[model samples]
Target: MAAGARVMFAPCISEGLLLRVQSLLYVGVSVESIMQRHNESVEKQGGPSNCNDLLTHSYVRRQERVIRRSIYELDADVAVSINMWVENHQSHVFFDEDFSDVDPLTLGIQTEWQLQQMIRFGNHSLIASDSRFRTTKLKYPVHSLLVINEDNKVIPVAWIVAPKFESSNAHKWMRAFYNRDQTKDPAWNLAGFIVDDPLADVLTISDVFQCSVMISFWRVHHAWHKNLVKKCVDNEMRATTSRRLHQAVDNICQQRGSKRLFEDFIEDFFDESDFVDYFKATWYPRIVFVVSDSQWGNRLYQEFHKPRAGVTMRKSKKKEEPVLEDLPKEYYDDVSAFIL
Candidate 1:
């Protein structure tokens, strides 16, 4: 067994050394010539006489086939089994090799009920979403959703690995978690969503649940698009433009403070047509504006523009009535930390 193991890895070691030499010195050397020289050196040193002799062996190929089969069989077995949180925490399949122009092949197994709970209950509430691809040519809309926990950290809630970014796929994901009866209790609902896109489809989840949710554009994407729109003269100018805009935003936030500057910030940075479309897509109007301090909370309350309560008018011996000023908006000591 040890001898067989040595034979299997000998070519890998030779290939590694040859690759390093080719990269550093012999840029024009072909792989075939490198292997031939390696084989001759091995034979001269009384090692394996022919490097390809073991590499091309039928037994080694058969062993590889068996190992791959074993993994597939294990994936099949795991797919058939279900336990508490088993499907939630880890991907069912270890490897998936299929690919198409639209979507990368994904080997994922999820139970319908598991997906349902994640959507309906905010089972993982603090969420981040984005699509990823392995190669530039092979595009797979693999969307990942992460849940933010009490510890102020994000964890994976689910993955929507598919060929297309169809809204139906997103709807299907929510269908698993939808329960019409649970609308009465806000605690068991979605709190917020953080995403890179304008969230045209994702915001629907908020409407269906009838929950107050905060949605924010991914900060990095905000900067990226800002730079992209500038049509700069060069890469350096593009970077400088983005940096300046970012700095300007920071200065505004720092100078005026978050609550006072919230509307100004929106108008200054995100007033483009694309930004408006994204903000208005779902039309829920609960985008979160992060404030710098507790005082800003009162400022936010003022901006909410809720009507003040009427005061009792008194008559005493026809005395002139005193005009009272509106009471200042009070801050709460224990504000709901639902979205935080």
Candidate 2:
């Protein structure tokens, strides 16, 4: 690598390491296999055979092929293979960071490396905004944005911040307006922006590119989650919420030379109306993923160990969970069920 680090094949992948990567780095599913699943789903949905009954030629073969290739690269990359993880429901569009598997020492390196890449060369716009949890009426609960690196550091390119805690009166009225329950999953309160170029696609790049980010940190926010109280924040006066870097980002994004998907701050999370129901984006999982351009791995292969063909997994001499043999095989039709 230009960074002066050379990776040598240390050993064959141990089943333990493979399982760790599958469960820890990737959350739990095979990125390679899942993308294959996604591509297959997209093609079918884009078909005249549309199941959702919507016409969408969104993922033609060429695009699917490109995505498939990217996925493979990530699965095989040293750095990426070592740190990425798969979470529940592997097909979800956004990936949550897996906090359990991360090694503390490398977190800084991984985070900074990724922050630099996204803010610098990866074509994207960063965003931030204040939002409320759906149930708690916790206004401007927590704000976040796609960290983009432009000045050689991962910084906010698009910034959004939540309002200070809404007054009790305001919260009551807000709940009444939305019929939200503070006890239920909170309302959706995240600010997101899109980049103007091909490389700017968030979900696509996130799955396709291998990054230096760890899976442990990106937990998905979910529906049905108790609405987190958005403790009132200090928003009386502020230059910009991109942590004092908004002006610079705005200047760069506004430049005729820079690429921007939407020229103005993304106001659609609230104004567009269709993004989600008013009940709240909270109480639901928020999928967050880091998209980057690097893929590296530290390989150390280990021998495969499993019971023989006739032996059930649970009954393997070690008494694992019973491996039922009667489950139906997943066919193409079954695989086509996840496109949304």
Candidate 3:
């Protein structure tokens, strides 16, 4: 962890634990598939970690208030996570790597692109304000990092995410406890731990809903890839984002287990353009796990979720009415023909 960087962590042990779980994945990110493979991977299962300790203190009248208050006190460069409320949070600045115009070679693990965005973060705020943004609220909290030209003073920035996370993970709870929208088939593609099977965490288990990460061989048109970069950037909230690349440093954070995040972290991107994109990518804890052990939960959040006296994450409520969902311009294409 970077000095002065804070890592905030929280475990979801609430009655709505599943909701929090759903909040972690982008639309279509599968939790059930992962669990299925987790079963086949671990042959030597041990005791499972206790979830009893995950519950918040009952003494706290407003638990949500506690969560909000926690954020208000966080220091800059703080890294925080909550398995219950939020999964991972990191902050870093990054610059593009110079690879002779050749995109960096990826490991044999095979990479794929999951998203693409042409709109910059600033303008999207208004566009996202539409009801479509409700589901995107939980999974991503990408904030832009700003610098003062005069003295180079660093300041943190933030923006609102419309559409919330509506992936398969989000629906897991509605189907389980609610019994209203369970997966079409219950036997496969489930997120809950089977408890009975213990050593099942070896395979990547990210095939079905994952974005196949691939190398980019051309100059980035931020406008064209803004959406895709933002998806990864939002997920990789903690990373360094800068214009200068350092050849001496290897991505140590990702080698151990953290997701491959850009060294650059963008709290906000005010410019709107397809040619320029900014944000960082990387995993939360940067810790590798031997999921074969039942104690995996103990380490599920090993490197994040800070409860230090002065560190936390924060959110502010706006009083505007819900944004309506109407297109700004009428299309010349025949409505019936285009509807199909």
Candidate 4:
């Protein structure tokens, strides 16, 4: 038995080294960095110096996978695991009526602490929401509801993991809060709402909360930049056109009760009737009617125009920002691809 045990253990990593690796991983050390340190330690001991011989990247990745599975049940079906978790925490977590049937599930989460924060800071204050796409391995979008705290720091009060950014999905996400039993007494009567996509979220907010809606200026600017890149031939034309359009928007937003139409302001800058018409139809109304409204204009300017540290008008920028036009072609092929 002793001889057999020795034979079995001879080719395996040392127990001490395995424990060390586990410890480092638990403290959040990167696999590559840990492997480099292991290599240095082996060299100091005058042993085989190659990390691959002892601690390969694949080995480390496997260990990471094991650790993550132990922590989060990574091997389980995502929807099943999420539903189980929600079942355990039913008081705070919420799901859509057809959660099981929905191709891409919608889940809303608010802890007791978060609910307190919302009641204290969010009531009668401007609430903001935005969605982050391709956030998880399943490529599900995370929708976040935010409010400014007493310390003047903007913090997320609730989170929604939704399938898409359509208005119907937005309605389901909003209903999670509106129908929450805990908040029924006080009710979530928001003074206003700020959202990145006015078309997707404004109507939902109006139906659910009956609040004034404001569009994030930065998101609108990014949309203009992105669309101009597609519509214009070269960078020079795009830049020139973008600058003129931004100026017109700024002037329009700054002016009180300005009757001049957005199309009229930009008509002289662009000779391309197609791009002009597209912008007019798609974006012009969103800016002029929703963002520049008298009820919300001053608040928008104060909150977004003069930017403070860590105060973003839109969702935190991802490593790769997706263009509005590219999303449908890229993601619509398999909505079920996001179901895991």
lDDT against true structure, model 3: 0.22
How large is the C-alpha RMSD of every model relative to the true structure? 19.8, 26.4, 25.5, 13.0
Q: For model 3, what is the alpha-carbon lDDT of residue 219?
A: 16
Model 1 spans > 4 angstroms off: 1-124, 133-139, 150-152, 163-166, 179-187, 212-215, 219-236, 247-340
- Write out the backbone clash pairs for model 4: none
Score each candidate by Cα lDDT: 0.38, 0.25, 0.22, 0.58
Q: Write the per-residue lDDT of candidate 4 for residues 213-321, one digit (tens) a residue.
A: 6555555666676777778777787777776666655554554434354656566755766568778888777555554445553444422233232222322376322
**lDDT tens digits, residues 1-340, model 1?**
9998775655443443432332312112344554565556567767664343323233333444543443332333333422222343343322233334444344333333323334443432334454443324443355655443333333344555555433544554444334421432334544344343433353465556443333232333343555456534456645644554344334433343333333543465453545434433422133322334344343221111223211112235476432211212221111111121
Estimate the overall C-alpha local distance difference test score of candidate 1: 0.38
Worst 10 residues of 3 by lDDT: 331-340
Ranking by TM-score: 4, 1, 3, 2
> 3 or 4, which is superior by TM-score?
4
- The model with the greatest lDDT is 4
